[model samples]
Target: MKKIVSLLLTATMVLGLAACGNTDEETPETPETPGEEETLTGTGEGYGGEVTVTVTMDGDTITNVVAEGPDETDGVGTPALEQLPEKFVEANSADVDVIAGATVTSRGLIYAMKNALDPDANPWPMVEEEEDPSNVEASDVALGFGISSLGRKGPGADDTETQVWSINEVLASALFDGEGKIIYLNVDQVEVATPNYDGEGMPHLSGWPGQGGYNIDEDHDEKVDGVTEDTEENFIAEVELWKTKRERGDDYKMGISTWSEQMDAYEETFVGMTVEEIEEWFEKYTSDRNGRPLKEGSEDAEDKAKYDALSAEDKEMLADVTTSATMSLNDSHGNIIEAIRKAYENRMGLEITEAEAAGFGVSFMPRIGPGKDDQDVQVYSLNQVFANTLFDEEGRVVAIHVDQLEVASPNYDGAGMPHFSGFPGQGGYNYDEDHDEKVDGKTEDTEENFFSEIESWMTKRERGDDYKMGISTWAEQMDGYEEVFIGKTVEEIEEWFDKYTSDRNGRALKDGSEDAEDKAKYDALSDEEKAMLADVTASATMSLNDAHGDIIKAIRASFENREVINLSVN
Candidate 1:
């Protein structure tokens, strides 16, 4: 199969409210330092014209705030000018609620007041009260990954929009509150073939990264990684660098806000909601066909019906949701709500704090190199893996999960899957090692046989003792690595990999290569490094990157993808 893996959500850290903090520094151009009482006047742009404010400060207290804008709209800007001054005087700060129908006027008045108070600040920013997570994992918390498809849209007949098939991967991650509610949620999606999807709307990806032809690279020839053909290798090479919606941040623009910002808005709305509640909310608020919130004044019959059906209170609620997010939550764009449901199903409890963080990632690879070298008897295997993590406020990995599923041709199953030649399913034949033949029970390869084994797609953990690693099962060793990673940060894990794993293959240092250089590197390890290396061998001996999978990459991304959550341990 091709590399049609689902997308992943990552975050760019957000700025806090330090901009709203009180400052003792005198205004940059204040004429003189006022001792007990001082009056300062400032002006700002309103909906119709300039709005002005004069602040009267008595010592540290705001004694009065007066705002005026003569050309402003009578009913809209007038009420804001008359009412917001008193609000500012009572609050003593420009950060407050925006007047419902007089947003521009209220904002202008607030900006003028802020200017009168400091003379050196931008008009008050439209800031929301966001609780960014400093921590994410608590004992009761769980991190999950949910993926869905947008199906596929045509390289359509429409000329107005670009003609291309879009193969989509919508992904969601959530921090579960352990009380059946989601504490934090992150969502993102990727459309693989924006301009060049196959006729069937399946993926026709090459090593090209963008709509503009392929990028030249040192490793890749011709175009992407230098390959001359559109093969699995070419696809893998291309997708490794692809960015999801959240990962693209500001570059992936939507309407007024970036994709990440809008997704953040949707994510915040999901907090404290159960999976069922979220589904109901999506169905009730969003359009039945497109999954977009109804516009208040839309003349379309369906939209008007939805708009009219909403109670006055629900209308306000819908307005609050649409202000920051208007992207379709499901339908052709992406089935985000379905992903959330999957996340709840996949949830695994961990001990973490709401102030901490959690993240999810997957690494995929297709291996078909020469191991048991035979021209016709070559092996092909595909590995897709996951290693999500939980972190404390200071970024220590508190919980780590490592699991994988390896599917391969019957001739070549790695340590994770044992290969028995000549079989439709279970094998009872013994192999003649010297003669290179099978003896006893006979089996043949056929379409029926191949189709029959479809149910044989088993996970490493599901394989249990069948997945032999000589010293232990694959699951046991992976578990041991998880133990090694506990309490370690991403940095520490990287350092550990550098010290103990072989640089060439990413396997445990000496197992894959014990050459002179490898021996020298191993011998030069400090005592602590050597001890840690020796200890880890008891559990695992697999590469985190080489032919196996990108476990390290997944872990690092999990850290980079951390976001604030509302989990509670107690």
Candidate 2:
């Protein structure tokens, strides 16, 4: 019976292929011309352009299938196009799952293949039904954070300099109701940079030693002779501007009426709407259904007519908020949907274990450097620490573990002279492993010990080069600091950080000061260790403050909004 079914399917495919000629209209099958392989071609509309598929068949079995969609997004759609042809040949049918996230492109390729193999037949697969959020009954808030860093290893030359590193961090949170409806959404993004270093790892002013050199004036409009309080003030103002843009609405100057209209349209389209419904609405705006560009004021009359006919809700979904504020409503909607899904799971009394409730914290050394060349080479030793805290259902931390990584370019020795060889050649230490278990009789390696290791490493790399200053690793300092954070609520952590990390003067809380206990461990280090500690303590304090501070802020913001919603409901 299986064999009979297979024969019948093969016969059906042959007849279908014969009907699918070069054009849509049926053409008589040509007798085999000398040295010509049987090939059929078809095209289907894709996300950005048409996707074409060519199929070559030997009798009833498909020998080859080639699909191409050049206009599609490279990482998202190209992968689907590259892999789907093989899938079709293996299955001998176009019935397959669309590549996750690249649905439109995958559908286009599949439709093209179906047209090539069987234009007259209904070879398209049935659309998957979206989960109905209306029936979902439980809701909870979930926060998601992502951090990415990019670095380049380079040696500076007389004519060129390298941008050593940069980091970008994003934090997003959403609140979902019992029905899996997103009630609130927020996102914050921050970026920081490291200084450019020379061949021997010595820090240099980028574009220095010339008129109109590297330093910027108060306005940051052009280079200046020197930096002053104004430079710091200006830099702070720029950071504030970036933060505002991320936290609030975009800074673009749209007409007040237009802005109000867009806001009203968004509220009408999305408020109290389920994720599925919101997605369907966005699809309409994104789709080129009438074979016309969906942008406002399209040149094509039909396209312009279609745009004009769209409801205000559709227009708002398609609206572009200036070139700089280019994030699409579709992207924001997706995030809200994910948050809703997570909230729905939590409301359903899903057993979320300690591992599932665990939160991760990350801290980078020198969180905000004075814009590259503001500090000396020795101060450039950078470290990143990632810590995860597993929490019980009661929201108490059950377990905590930390891993740290550090990198340093070449730097000046104790004499304030550049090292002969920089970075990869001088080689930095991995404090996580290469340090002594016990230093100066303190037992477990601490920040002072880590700094001692760094000094020793730096000293040995260049003979006669000594770093006699007091040294303190951010990790060692954070060891005691971490204790203050453990078992505390995120809000408590934020309060503690704001009060204890820095003094009234904005310096690291010193040994014998109000937060002396945290500093006492460092004070016990040798005279040289104390001196080495001086340069980094302030920067490390600021860095630690920013890293943990941001996480706490994100959590606090999420819960605060959650509370507001609950109050309104009550």
Q: After best superposition, candidate 2 residue 271: deviation in angstroms?
A: 4.4
RMSD of each: 16.9, 22.0
Query: Which stretches of candidate 2 lie above 4 Å from their native place?
Result: 1-171, 177-181, 187-242, 246-252, 255-268, 271-280, 286-516, 519-563, 567-570
Ten-residue region with minimum lDDT total, candidate 2:
202-211
State model 1's lDDT: 0.63
Candidate 2: lDDT of 41?
85
Model 2, TM vs. native: 0.31
Model 1 regions lying over 4 Å from their true place = 1-119, 123-139, 155-163, 194-204, 207-237, 352-355, 359-387, 402-477, 510-516, 523-535, 564-568
lDDT of each: 0.63, 0.42
- For candidate 2, the lDDT comes to 0.42
Model 2 Cα lDDT, one tens digit per residue, 321-422:
221121333231123233233223322211222222434444333223212321322223333344434344345443333333343322211232221112
The lowest-lDDT stretch of 10 consecutive residues in candidate 1 is: 5-14
Please state the error at residue 29 of candidate 1 in Å: 40
